[model samples]
Target: MRLSIRSWVKRVTITGSILAISLVSIGCFYEQAARSRAIKDFPAPGKLVDIGGRQIHLNCQGRGTPLVVLEAGADTSGSALWQPVQEQVARFTRVCSYDRAGIMWSDPAKGQRNSHAIAEDLHKVLRAANEQPPYILAGASMGGPYVMTFTKYYRKEVAGMVLVDASHPDQTARLAQATGEPASNPIPMAFRALAAVAWTGLPRLVLPDAEVPELPSQTAKAITAYQPTSLAAAFAEAAVFEDSLREAGTFRTLGHLPLAVLSRGKPWSAFSEAERAAGGLTREQFNRAEAAWANMQAEEAGWSSNSTHQVLADSSHVMQLERPDAVIAAIRDVVVRATRANATP
Candidate 1:
């Protein structure tokens, strides 16, 4: 059941706060020209396949069965951000990482940026790229829900799964309960404002170069160049975050599928005194949220009858960057298990 692009993006909304704009900026045309030059200078490391009318960047490498698909966090982070993890996964099995709509080298989204559209774009891109499945999905952070939505719609094509400190459908409510109030999430508003002025080179003027020291030097350099220009994709995903979470919430069970749920050991919101003051989140509140998050991860393991849960005590929310070894081992384990299951007549 393919959804038309029109229905896929019925309504577009970016109702949120902003990071106060200052008019010290270049003209849109100048910034666009510079953006184009930046894109050319740091060319896409993968092929851009036409998914529907829009193009999506897909980086595929290595060769083996049960192809691994890497879904990045729905932020300015793109397929290239999975440098360390993908490199190792490629050694054992075929793997592909892609930039979602309006991200990196990919075209802007055609419609609503919910999980359904997100999953379909991936499906279309995979079809266009002729990447066969029985796919092994490894989703980190928000990528977890995107993975679930994919499995919800295309369960047969999925052989195994890994959720790395993934979001829970009830995370908003759960965390709100822990913190004693609903979160007035500032990330969306900040991204929305950033996107509005990114074309005018505001991001380049005020934003610092991306700091991803975990990635190789060249990959890190590419992120610095792309960060200022990719706010459109970041904002697009941020705007519909709740919608995506709700959509994924419905996909609760994975039945007999092989699964691995990895959660970070440290508190995701371990803010400093000043940072905590800004968000009105105290250290005690942060601790409660962390505990809630751990409970949620334990529950996620039950989604599949055959599953394993690992707590990477030294890792944080960005486990892919902080603990690529564990991430790779989990994927490889799932792939091996999926293969063994498939072979069982």
Candidate 2:
């Protein structure tokens, strides 16, 4: 018993020491992140527009009849993240994309992050930037709802929509159900708890040296210059919006808008051994989740007077990024169809 007690004490001490070291390391990273973000020298591709009190980074490129707008996923990606598609499609139509509030160079706001609120902010940015009415809103993952809400709130302004692996409410329920096994575990509760702290505190250290890969080289450098402080601001704004998404019936209004959904053909749950070996599982898991989410969004889209679905059997959730040529062709086809259907008289 005495030996067991001694061993237990030693283990406790070791654990405590490891925890202390971890905390110190995190603190150091945060400091570096902050310092890196503070310097004011970086290049930006678009004009910086001031909306209310926030400075939003924006760019309008290409030229054509129908204006195309690309919206990104959650906190993990930004408008610049759609580089592959933009580079290709810009030749055919006017393509515009901007970082949402609290992302990259976009100024963080103290406003609510709900679908409606975000839609309103986007409208304000569009107007201020003079992008004008008649927008083809294309979104991936979480961005689907933002564009959907925009069309719902600003109907006349939206011409059509393209949802790339959109989110659905039922998926959340399915995920809850999936928690019965280790395979479908909803990110460990302990990890979530730790993540909450990291979200708030780590920004203090990481923003300084943090590197966002999605942004164009120049834009990334420009945005990274704002580090810790600006990054924290952006993170806070996202938290507010994420909280709103968690609320019941936050995006039900999307059902009444014109939309098209393109789902990935592959499912992570169905990944094979060869696929896992090829890194498909790592990239395919998120796409699989998004594909499931698209199905969830489909329910609401069906209720809408104007909505359609498309399955990209040969692509992943990141069809736009992974298969730019195919994505452009899909977008062009959708636009043509929407135009034809709308023009029928």
Candidate 3:
């Protein structure tokens, strides 16, 4: 059959769309089955507290005052990210970690996923769980701002804070100006593609988040199992990351509050080889980024007069996991200082 080129192109387009639809259906089925299996295999370790109509996962341990509330960063396995830290901190004082809505076992949340919204949800979960105040908050990455927002709202309740390689509110603008590159995800297109097919469960096979070797064995297992299911939620949070930063930016300062700003010394580790290749980021650009990051961390430390700023010389962004000793020391230091202040009065 001698078909016109226009007709042939039209047919190909229709056929391609049909094939895409079929693939999406198959992917959806695969995704649902995988989700079922995953839920069965890895149930929520903590109890689900009813925060209004929806419930969020909250895990608390130990038995003492000045509770340590840990907030995990963007695209992380929420509470599992703090297992190692929580375990140790729990020995001396009460510590808790929870998944934000739509992350891990928590109920799906609605509205803008900004830091303020996240902090509000955490407050609800804490109240629902009967977890009292006098909290020492430890937030890592985006979690830094989440905890900061919490401190802002519950000022009197907060005892201290620990920012673990925390995100700076102005880093996006500052880094862009510093490096001559727009602030962006390491691989935006790739992430978007994965996010698109995330429901079809293709990324689950392609980007299997197995054991995070840097973390403890048990913690790694929990994160591995929960992570695959939370990819969409993680990316969703990443999408609104700038909003979260801006919301956290409103936090004027911690005053003379006991605070610890733990910055990563090995900033280059944050920009991976793949990231450099994908973004065409050069050594000079990365060096500029590191310089900006160091300066930003110093500024974050200045948020408090009674604050200690330390750069973990051997650590990366996930310094809590890479250098747990340093993270533990920082959190414990804040906790100790906070406790002393409380005792003095």
Candidate 4:
């Protein structure tokens, strides 16, 4: 007894749907198991202090005057991201790092994830943790804007700043103009997709270890454990990027504060052959775009009356990972200058 065509099609569709649902359920179960394991294996190494209703994770080390505060890049886990640089800075002055709300071990908060809100959160966490200032704030990538916003609102608290391949306020527009590409962010969508898939435990199977740096076993495990949460928080932040950029623009100057801008000196060779071809850009065009980016970074150094800009020729955008010494040195320079300034008069 052969089935009719309509019956056969309906049977096939139902079978496919059932199979898909079953696979998804299995993936979700595995994901939950992984999450449970992560929670058990990796606990927060720092203090989780209540800031308003939400808890923020604060990690402080070393002991000295003029504390150093490290801010991680967009979507990055804070203290873990600063591991290499923070350890060395701790050798001299007290240094601290923290996870912003909704990242890592930090509890989620209700608000727009713009620079202003982020900076406010940082200020609240620091005060709650009893860390005093004049602080030497170091920001990398998007973290640059948050630190700058902090300096703007709490001018008296900040002693100095280090911008490590920091994002310029005009970076999006400038890059768009330079590359002849429209300024837009696909990060939110990308992360949202990842979040959905991650819940299915697909990420555990497909996520590569290539991007994970050589860190302590515990740190590595923690990072892996928190990837999904970090991605979601990053998506929130990325979604408000334009607003964040506008907020950053309101900050006019650093007002004679000590500043160090570390720019990436490498070329734009990270673009694959396929990507470059897709963009319809010649090699020369790519080089020009990179030069424009470096120029914009140099301009960021000029925001401070007393500022110095250095191009890290041997490094990429993630200079902390590539050349931790350079970042440490910049922080040291600003700290020494800040110390000298404090002693004078």
Query: Best candidate per lDDT, number?
Result: 1
Q: 1-345 in candidate 4: lDDT tens per residue?
A: 356888999999999999999999998998898878877898888899998888999999999979999999986455687888989999999999999887888887777899989999999999999999999999999989889888889999999999999888888878778877676554746557876677788767765542446467678778877776566677778889888878988895987899999999875666578866765677876776787888989889889898989998789888898899999999999999999989999
lDDT of 4: 0.85
**Local error of candidate 1 at residue 114 (angstroms):** 0.5
The residue pairs found clashing in candidate 1 are 9-111, 9-112
Over the full model, what C-alpha lDDT does candidate 1 score relative to the true structure? 0.86
Ranking by TM-score: 4, 1, 3, 2
Assess candidate 3 and give its TM-score to the true structure: 0.89
Task: After the best TM-score superposition of candidate 2, give how far the Cα of residue 37 lies from its true spot, in angstroms.
Answer: 7.2
RMSD of each: 10.9, 7.3, 3.1, 2.7
- Point out the worst 10-residue segment of candidate 3 by lDDT: 219-228
Best by TM-score: 4
- TM-score per prediction, in order, is 0.89, 0.68, 0.89, 0.90
lDDT score for residue 290 of model 1: 83
C-alpha lDDT of all candidate models, in order? 0.86, 0.64, 0.84, 0.85
Error of 4 at 147 (Å): 0.6
Worst 10 residues of 2 by lDDT: 178-187
